[model samples]
Target: MGFLIGQTYRKMVGILAARFKEYDITTEQFSVLCRLAEQDGISQKEIAARTVKDQPTTARILDCLIRKGLVHKEMSAADRRSFLVYLTPLGRERLDVLLPLEKATLAEIFAGLDAEELARFRETHLQLHRQLDALHQQQEA
Candidate 1:
Protein backbone atom coordinates (compact mmCIF):
# COMPACT_ATOMS: atom_id res chain seq x y z
CA MET A 1 0.00 0.00 0.00
CA GLY A 2 2.86 2.36 0.85
CA PHE A 3 4.57 1.52 -2.43
CA LEU A 4 1.36 2.18 -4.35
CA ILE A 5 0.85 5.49 -2.56
CA GLY A 6 4.44 6.57 -3.11
CA GLN A 7 4.38 5.56 -6.74
CA THR A 8 1.15 7.41 -7.34
CA TYR A 9 2.61 10.49 -5.70
CA ARG A 10 5.76 10.24 -7.82
CA LYS A 11 3.73 9.84 -10.98
CA MET A 12 1.53 12.82 -10.21
CA VAL A 13 4.47 15.01 -9.28
CA GLY A 14 6.37 13.96 -12.37
CA ILE A 15 3.46 14.93 -14.59
CA LEU A 16 2.99 18.26 -12.86
CA ALA A 17 6.71 19.06 -12.97
CA ALA A 18 6.85 18.40 -16.69
CA ARG A 19 3.84 20.62 -17.21
CA PHE A 20 5.38 23.36 -15.06
CA LYS A 21 8.80 23.36 -16.78
CA GLU A 22 7.99 26.16 -19.17
CA TYR A 23 6.96 28.31 -16.21
CA ASP A 24 10.36 27.62 -14.57
CA ILE A 25 8.83 26.12 -11.43
CA THR A 26 8.85 22.72 -9.83
CA THR A 27 5.72 21.08 -8.43
CA GLU A 28 6.94 21.87 -4.92
CA GLN A 29 7.41 25.56 -5.76
CA PHE A 30 4.08 25.60 -7.54
CA SER A 31 2.44 24.09 -4.46
CA VAL A 32 3.90 26.88 -2.32
CA LEU A 33 2.57 29.42 -4.76
CA CYS A 34 -0.85 27.80 -4.63
CA ARG A 35 -0.87 27.97 -0.85
CA LEU A 36 0.08 31.64 -0.92
CA ALA A 37 -2.50 32.35 -3.60
CA GLU A 38 -5.16 30.99 -1.29
CA GLN A 39 -3.89 33.25 1.51
CA ASP A 40 -0.89 35.53 1.42
CA GLY A 41 1.11 37.56 3.94
CA ILE A 42 1.96 34.59 6.15
CA SER A 43 5.12 34.01 8.14
CA GLN A 44 7.84 31.61 6.93
CA LYS A 45 7.08 29.33 9.85
CA GLU A 46 3.43 29.23 8.89
CA ILE A 47 4.32 28.45 5.29
CA ALA A 48 6.58 25.63 6.45
CA ALA A 49 3.85 24.19 8.65
CA ARG A 50 1.18 24.54 5.98
CA THR A 51 3.41 22.99 3.34
CA VAL A 52 4.49 20.14 5.68
CA LYS A 53 8.14 20.96 5.08
CA ASP A 54 11.01 21.76 7.40
CA GLN A 55 11.78 25.44 8.00
CA PRO A 56 15.09 25.27 6.12
CA THR A 57 13.45 23.71 3.06
CA THR A 58 10.67 26.27 3.08
CA ALA A 59 13.15 29.10 3.46
CA ARG A 60 15.15 27.82 0.51
CA ILE A 61 12.03 27.70 -1.63
CA LEU A 62 11.00 31.20 -0.62
CA ASP A 63 14.51 32.46 -1.29
CA CYS A 64 14.40 31.07 -4.81
CA LEU A 65 11.01 32.67 -5.38
CA ILE A 66 12.35 35.98 -4.13
CA ARG A 67 15.28 35.77 -6.55
CA LYS A 68 12.79 35.18 -9.35
CA GLY A 69 10.82 38.23 -8.25
CA LEU A 70 7.74 36.04 -7.74
CA VAL A 71 7.49 36.49 -3.99
CA HIS A 72 8.81 38.86 -1.35
CA LYS A 73 9.11 38.95 2.42
CA GLU A 74 8.72 41.91 4.79
CA MET A 75 9.28 42.28 8.52
CA SER A 76 5.99 41.46 10.19
CA ALA A 77 4.50 44.42 12.02
CA ALA A 78 2.99 42.11 14.62
CA ASP A 79 6.10 39.97 15.01
CA ARG A 80 9.44 41.73 14.97
CA ARG A 81 11.35 38.47 14.72
CA SER A 82 9.71 36.93 11.66
CA PHE A 83 8.97 38.11 8.13
CA LEU A 84 5.64 37.77 6.34
CA VAL A 85 5.66 36.39 2.81
CA TYR A 86 3.65 37.82 -0.04
CA LEU A 87 3.20 37.20 -3.75
CA THR A 88 4.39 39.96 -6.04
CA PRO A 89 2.36 41.13 -9.03
CA LEU A 90 4.57 38.91 -11.15
CA GLY A 91 3.67 35.99 -8.93
CA ARG A 92 -0.04 36.59 -9.38
CA GLU A 93 0.41 36.89 -13.12
CA ARG A 94 2.41 33.67 -13.20
CA LEU A 95 -0.31 31.98 -11.19
CA ASP A 96 -2.93 33.19 -13.62
CA VAL A 97 -1.09 31.39 -16.38
CA LEU A 98 -0.07 28.29 -14.44
CA LEU A 99 -3.36 27.74 -12.58
CA PRO A 100 -5.14 26.59 -15.71
CA LEU A 101 -2.19 24.45 -16.68
CA GLU A 102 -2.24 22.90 -13.24
CA LYS A 103 -5.94 22.18 -13.51
CA ALA A 104 -5.50 20.65 -16.92
CA THR A 105 -2.52 18.57 -15.81
CA LEU A 106 -4.42 17.25 -12.78
CA ALA A 107 -7.45 16.51 -14.92
CA GLU A 108 -5.24 14.35 -17.07
CA ILE A 109 -4.00 12.53 -14.00
CA PHE A 110 -7.57 11.81 -12.83
CA ALA A 111 -8.93 11.22 -16.30
CA GLY A 112 -11.37 8.40 -15.67
CA LEU A 113 -12.30 9.07 -12.06
CA ASP A 114 -15.77 10.35 -11.28
CA ALA A 115 -16.62 12.90 -8.59
CA GLU A 116 -17.80 10.30 -6.06
CA GLU A 117 -14.70 8.16 -6.33
CA LEU A 118 -12.48 11.22 -6.05
CA ALA A 119 -14.30 12.31 -2.90
CA ARG A 120 -13.93 8.89 -1.34
CA PHE A 121 -10.26 8.77 -2.27
CA ARG A 122 -9.69 12.14 -0.67
CA GLU A 123 -11.47 11.13 2.52
CA THR A 124 -9.60 7.85 2.75
CA HIS A 125 -6.25 9.61 2.40
CA LEU A 126 -7.18 12.13 5.06
CA GLN A 127 -8.16 9.33 7.40
CA LEU A 128 -4.87 7.56 6.77
CA HIS A 129 -2.92 10.73 7.58
CA ARG A 130 -4.92 11.25 10.76
CA GLN A 131 -4.23 7.68 11.85
CA LEU A 132 -0.52 8.05 11.11
CA ASP A 133 -0.39 11.32 13.00
CA ALA A 134 -2.02 9.72 16.01
CA LEU A 135 0.49 6.89 15.89
CA HIS A 136 3.38 9.34 15.75
CA GLN A 137 2.01 11.24 18.75
CA GLN A 138 1.67 8.00 20.68
CA GLN A 139 5.28 7.10 19.94
CA GLU A 140 6.47 10.52 21.06
CA ALA A 141 4.50 10.30 24.24
Candidate 2:
Protein backbone atom coordinates (compact mmCIF):
# COMPACT_ATOMS: atom_id res chain seq x y z
CA MET A 1 0.00 0.00 0.00
CA GLY A 2 2.84 2.40 0.81
CA PHE A 3 4.52 1.48 -2.45
CA LEU A 4 1.36 2.17 -4.41
CA ILE A 5 0.91 5.47 -2.63
CA GLY A 6 4.49 6.48 -3.40
CA GLN A 7 4.07 5.49 -7.04
CA THR A 8 0.84 7.45 -7.35
CA TYR A 9 2.50 10.52 -5.79
CA ARG A 10 5.40 10.38 -8.24
CA LYS A 11 3.04 9.92 -11.20
CA MET A 12 0.91 12.85 -10.08
CA VAL A 13 3.99 15.05 -9.72
CA GLY A 14 5.15 14.02 -13.18
CA ILE A 15 1.79 14.89 -14.70
CA LEU A 16 1.68 18.25 -12.96
CA ALA A 17 5.29 18.98 -13.93
CA ALA A 18 4.50 18.25 -17.56
CA ARG A 19 1.49 20.53 -17.42
CA PHE A 20 3.53 23.31 -15.79
CA LYS A 21 6.45 22.93 -18.19
CA GLU A 22 5.31 25.76 -20.44
CA TYR A 23 5.34 28.13 -17.47
CA ASP A 24 8.77 26.86 -16.40
CA ILE A 25 7.54 25.95 -12.93
CA THR A 26 7.77 22.71 -10.95
CA THR A 27 5.07 21.06 -8.89
CA GLU A 28 6.77 22.22 -5.70
CA GLN A 29 6.91 25.79 -6.92
CA PHE A 30 3.25 25.67 -7.89
CA SER A 31 2.37 24.47 -4.42
CA VAL A 32 4.23 27.37 -2.82
CA LEU A 33 2.65 29.80 -5.25
CA CYS A 34 -0.80 28.50 -4.39
CA ARG A 35 -0.12 29.08 -0.71
CA LEU A 36 1.10 32.60 -1.33
CA ALA A 37 -1.97 33.30 -3.47
CA GLU A 38 -4.15 32.30 -0.57
CA GLN A 39 -2.27 34.57 1.85
CA ASP A 40 0.24 37.05 0.62
CA GLY A 41 2.94 38.78 2.65
CA ILE A 42 3.41 35.81 4.91
CA SER A 43 6.70 34.94 6.55
CA GLN A 44 8.87 32.24 4.98
CA LYS A 45 8.49 30.17 8.12
CA GLU A 46 4.74 30.26 7.73
CA ILE A 47 5.04 29.32 4.06
CA ALA A 48 7.39 26.48 4.95
CA ALA A 49 4.99 25.20 7.59
CA ARG A 50 1.96 25.45 5.33
CA THR A 51 3.77 23.72 2.48
CA VAL A 52 5.25 21.00 4.73
CA LYS A 53 8.73 21.88 3.52
CA ASP A 54 11.83 22.53 5.55
CA GLN A 55 13.18 26.07 5.74
CA PRO A 56 16.17 25.24 3.52
CA THR A 57 14.03 23.59 0.86
CA THR A 58 11.49 26.39 0.99
CA ALA A 59 14.31 28.96 0.72
CA ARG A 60 15.63 27.21 -2.39
CA ILE A 61 12.16 27.15 -3.96
CA LEU A 62 11.71 30.82 -3.11
CA ASP A 63 15.07 31.56 -4.70
CA CYS A 64 13.92 29.98 -7.94
CA LEU A 65 10.65 31.86 -7.87
CA ILE A 66 12.47 35.11 -7.06
CA ARG A 67 14.82 34.50 -9.98
CA LYS A 68 11.87 34.03 -12.26
CA GLY A 69 10.37 37.31 -11.01
CA LEU A 70 7.35 35.44 -9.69
CA VAL A 71 7.95 36.15 -6.03
CA HIS A 72 9.64 38.77 -3.86
CA LYS A 73 10.65 38.91 -0.23
CA GLU A 74 10.74 41.84 2.12
CA MET A 75 12.34 41.98 5.50
CA SER A 76 9.74 41.74 8.23
CA ALA A 77 9.47 44.72 10.53
CA ALA A 78 8.62 42.47 13.44
CA ASP A 79 11.65 40.32 12.78
CA ARG A 80 14.38 41.70 10.62
CA ARG A 81 16.01 38.30 10.34
CA SER A 82 12.93 36.85 8.72
CA PHE A 83 11.35 37.89 5.44
CA LEU A 84 7.75 38.14 4.36
CA VAL A 85 7.00 36.56 0.98
CA TYR A 86 4.62 37.81 -1.63
CA LEU A 87 3.68 36.99 -5.21
CA THR A 88 4.53 39.41 -7.93
CA PRO A 89 1.85 40.43 -10.40
CA LEU A 90 3.41 37.98 -12.80
CA GLY A 91 3.08 35.27 -10.20
CA ARG A 92 -0.56 36.03 -9.61
CA GLU A 93 -1.22 35.99 -13.37
CA ARG A 94 0.61 32.71 -13.74
CA LEU A 95 -1.35 31.25 -10.87
CA ASP A 96 -4.57 32.34 -12.50
CA VAL A 97 -3.60 30.39 -15.60
CA LEU A 98 -2.29 27.39 -13.67
CA LEU A 99 -5.21 27.06 -11.26
CA PRO A 100 -7.53 25.86 -13.99
CA LEU A 101 -4.90 23.50 -15.30
CA GLU A 102 -4.48 22.04 -11.83
CA LYS A 103 -8.22 21.62 -11.41
CA ALA A 104 -8.53 20.04 -14.82
CA THR A 105 -5.69 17.66 -14.09
CA LEU A 106 -7.31 16.61 -10.81
CA ALA A 107 -10.66 16.22 -12.54
CA GLU A 108 -9.06 14.02 -15.19
CA ILE A 109 -7.21 11.95 -12.62
CA PHE A 110 -10.30 11.40 -10.46
CA ALA A 111 -12.73 11.04 -13.37
CA GLY A 112 -13.41 7.42 -12.60
CA LEU A 113 -14.42 8.19 -9.00
CA ASP A 114 -17.97 9.43 -8.49
CA ALA A 115 -18.80 12.16 -5.98
CA GLU A 116 -19.49 9.72 -3.15
CA GLU A 117 -16.32 7.76 -3.79
CA LEU A 118 -14.27 10.93 -3.90
CA ALA A 119 -15.77 12.07 -0.63
CA ARG A 120 -14.93 8.72 0.95
CA PHE A 121 -11.41 8.90 -0.44
CA ARG A 122 -10.96 12.37 0.99
CA GLU A 123 -12.27 11.25 4.38
CA THR A 124 -9.95 8.27 4.40
CA HIS A 125 -6.97 10.50 3.60
CA LEU A 126 -8.00 12.93 6.32
CA GLN A 127 -8.23 10.10 8.83
CA LEU A 128 -4.82 8.84 7.82
CA HIS A 129 -3.44 12.35 8.26
CA ARG A 130 -4.92 12.59 11.73
CA GLN A 131 -3.40 9.25 12.67
CA LEU A 132 -0.03 10.34 11.38
CA ASP A 133 -0.29 13.61 13.28
CA ALA A 134 -0.97 11.70 16.46
CA LEU A 135 2.04 9.49 15.85
CA HIS A 136 4.19 12.55 15.22
CA GLN A 137 3.02 14.19 18.43
CA GLN A 138 3.68 11.02 20.38
CA GLN A 139 7.21 10.92 19.03
CA GLU A 140 7.75 14.54 20.04
CA ALA A 141 6.41 13.88 23.51
Candidate 3:
Protein backbone atom coordinates (compact mmCIF):
# COMPACT_ATOMS: atom_id res chain seq x y z
CA MET A 1 0.00 0.00 0.00
CA GLY A 2 2.77 2.38 0.98
CA PHE A 3 4.72 1.55 -2.15
CA LEU A 4 1.70 2.21 -4.35
CA ILE A 5 1.00 5.53 -2.62
CA GLY A 6 4.62 6.59 -2.88
CA GLN A 7 4.83 5.73 -6.56
CA THR A 8 1.64 7.58 -7.38
CA TYR A 9 2.68 10.72 -5.50
CA ARG A 10 6.23 10.65 -6.83
CA LYS A 11 5.18 10.43 -10.48
CA MET A 12 2.79 13.36 -10.08
CA VAL A 13 5.40 15.43 -8.26
CA GLY A 14 8.20 14.53 -10.67
CA ILE A 15 6.30 15.69 -13.72
CA LEU A 16 5.21 18.94 -12.07
CA ALA A 17 8.71 19.58 -10.67
CA ALA A 18 10.35 19.14 -14.05
CA ARG A 19 7.92 21.48 -15.77
CA PHE A 20 8.14 24.03 -12.97
CA LYS A 21 11.92 23.93 -13.20
CA GLU A 22 11.74 24.53 -16.96
CA TYR A 23 9.68 27.66 -16.30
CA ASP A 24 11.89 28.73 -13.35
CA ILE A 25 8.91 28.69 -10.99
CA THR A 26 8.00 26.43 -8.14
CA THR A 27 4.80 24.40 -8.37
CA GLU A 28 3.14 26.35 -5.58
CA GLN A 29 3.96 29.69 -7.19
CA PHE A 30 2.67 28.54 -10.57
CA SER A 31 -0.60 27.46 -8.95
CA VAL A 32 -0.98 30.94 -7.47
CA LEU A 33 -0.35 32.63 -10.80
CA CYS A 34 -2.74 30.32 -12.63
CA ARG A 35 -5.42 30.99 -10.05
CA LEU A 36 -4.91 34.74 -10.30
CA ALA A 37 -5.02 34.61 -14.08
CA GLU A 38 -8.30 32.76 -14.04
CA GLN A 39 -9.87 34.76 -11.24
CA ASP A 40 -8.28 38.15 -11.39
CA GLY A 41 -8.87 40.56 -8.52
CA ILE A 42 -9.65 37.72 -6.15
CA SER A 43 -8.76 38.15 -2.51
CA GLN A 44 -5.71 36.46 -1.03
CA LYS A 45 -8.04 34.61 1.33
CA GLU A 46 -9.92 33.23 -1.64
CA ILE A 47 -6.67 32.20 -3.31
CA ALA A 48 -5.67 30.39 -0.15
CA ALA A 49 -9.00 28.55 -0.14
CA ARG A 50 -8.66 27.54 -3.75
CA THR A 51 -5.06 26.44 -3.42
CA VAL A 52 -5.62 24.60 -0.12
CA LYS A 53 -2.67 26.48 1.33
CA ASP A 54 -2.45 28.23 4.66
CA GLN A 55 -2.78 32.00 4.66
CA PRO A 56 0.79 32.69 5.76
CA THR A 57 2.26 30.37 3.13
CA THR A 58 0.11 31.94 0.44
CA ALA A 59 1.06 35.41 1.65
CA ARG A 60 4.76 34.57 1.42
CA ILE A 61 4.38 33.19 -2.09
CA LEU A 62 2.49 36.33 -3.10
CA ASP A 63 5.23 38.45 -1.57
CA CYS A 64 7.80 36.76 -3.80
CA LEU A 65 5.62 37.23 -6.88
CA ILE A 66 5.09 40.90 -5.96
CA ARG A 67 8.83 41.43 -5.59
CA LYS A 68 9.41 39.83 -8.98
CA GLY A 69 6.81 42.24 -10.42
CA LEU A 70 4.62 39.41 -11.58
CA VAL A 71 1.62 40.29 -9.41
CA HIS A 72 0.15 43.43 -7.90
CA LYS A 73 -2.06 43.63 -4.85
CA GLU A 74 -4.43 46.50 -4.27
CA MET A 75 -6.69 47.29 -1.39
CA SER A 76 -10.23 46.14 -2.12
CA ALA A 77 -12.42 49.18 -2.66
CA ALA A 78 -15.45 47.48 -1.19
CA ASP A 79 -13.70 45.80 1.70
CA ARG A 80 -11.12 47.66 3.73
CA ARG A 81 -9.93 44.43 5.35
CA SER A 82 -9.28 42.55 2.13
CA PHE A 83 -6.83 43.08 -0.73
CA LEU A 84 -7.49 42.06 -4.31
CA VAL A 85 -4.76 40.44 -6.37
CA TYR A 86 -4.17 40.63 -10.10
CA LEU A 87 -1.35 39.64 -12.39
CA THR A 88 0.92 42.36 -13.65
CA PRO A 89 1.68 42.58 -17.36
CA LEU A 90 4.87 40.69 -16.72
CA GLY A 91 2.95 37.93 -15.01
CA ARG A 92 0.57 37.51 -17.91
CA GLU A 93 3.46 37.37 -20.36
CA ARG A 94 5.33 34.84 -18.28
CA LEU A 95 2.24 32.69 -17.87
CA ASP A 96 1.59 32.79 -21.61
CA VAL A 97 5.03 31.31 -22.17
CA LEU A 98 4.60 28.73 -19.44
CA LEU A 99 1.14 27.57 -20.55
CA PRO A 100 2.43 26.08 -23.79
CA LEU A 101 5.04 24.15 -21.88
CA GLU A 102 2.34 22.98 -19.48
CA LYS A 103 0.21 21.75 -22.37
CA ALA A 104 3.18 19.97 -23.88
CA THR A 105 4.01 18.34 -20.58
CA LEU A 106 0.43 17.11 -20.18
CA ALA A 107 0.44 15.79 -23.73
CA GLU A 108 3.68 13.97 -23.16
CA ILE A 109 2.34 12.34 -20.04
CA PHE A 110 -0.78 11.09 -21.79
CA ALA A 111 0.80 10.33 -25.19
CA GLY A 112 1.20 6.63 -24.82
CA LEU A 113 -2.27 5.97 -23.48
CA ASP A 114 -5.00 4.99 -25.92
CA ALA A 115 -8.31 6.85 -26.00
CA GLU A 116 -10.14 4.27 -23.91
CA GLU A 117 -7.32 4.14 -21.42
CA LEU A 118 -7.30 7.92 -21.22
CA ALA A 119 -10.99 8.06 -20.56
CA ARG A 120 -10.80 5.37 -17.96
CA PHE A 121 -7.87 7.06 -16.28
CA ARG A 122 -9.69 10.37 -16.05
CA GLU A 123 -12.79 8.70 -14.68
CA THR A 124 -10.82 6.92 -12.01
CA HIS A 125 -8.90 10.06 -11.14
CA LEU A 126 -12.08 12.02 -10.66
CA GLN A 127 -13.58 9.27 -8.53
CA LEU A 128 -10.50 9.18 -6.36
CA HIS A 129 -10.59 12.91 -5.96
CA ARG A 130 -14.21 12.85 -4.89
CA GLN A 131 -13.47 10.17 -2.35
CA LEU A 132 -10.57 12.18 -1.03
CA ASP A 133 -12.67 15.28 -0.76
CA ALA A 134 -15.27 13.38 1.21
CA LEU A 135 -12.57 12.14 3.54
CA HIS A 136 -11.23 15.65 3.97
CA GLN A 137 -14.65 17.00 4.79
CA GLN A 138 -15.17 14.21 7.28
CA GLN A 139 -11.86 14.98 8.94
CA GLU A 140 -12.68 18.65 9.11
CA ALA A 141 -16.02 17.88 10.64
Clash count, one per candidate? 0, 0, 0
What's the best-to-worst order under lDDT? Answer: 2, 1, 3
Model 2 earns a TM-score of 0.97
Report the CA-based lDDT of candidate 2 relative to the real structure. Answer: 0.96
Error of 2 at 113 (Å): 0.5
Candidate 2: where is the Cα deviation over 4 Å?
Answer: none
Quick one: best TM-score, which candidate?
2
- Residue 94 local lDDT, model 3: 89
Q: Look at candidate 3 and tell me the lDDT of residue 81.
A: 90
TM agreement with the true structure for every prediction: 0.94, 0.97, 0.87
| Per-residue accuracy of model 2 over 87-135 as CA lDDT, tens digit each | 9999999999999999999999999999999999999999998999899
lDDT of each: 0.92, 0.96, 0.89
Q: Write the per-residue lDDT of candidate 3 for residues 31-116, one digit (tens) a residue.
A: 89999988899999999999989999999999999998999999999999999999999999989988787788888878999999
Residue-level lDDT tens digits of model 1 in 13-103: 8888888998899888887898899999999898998898999999899999999999999999988998999999999999999999989
Q: After superposition, how far is residue 102 of candidate 2 from its true place, in Å?
A: 0.4
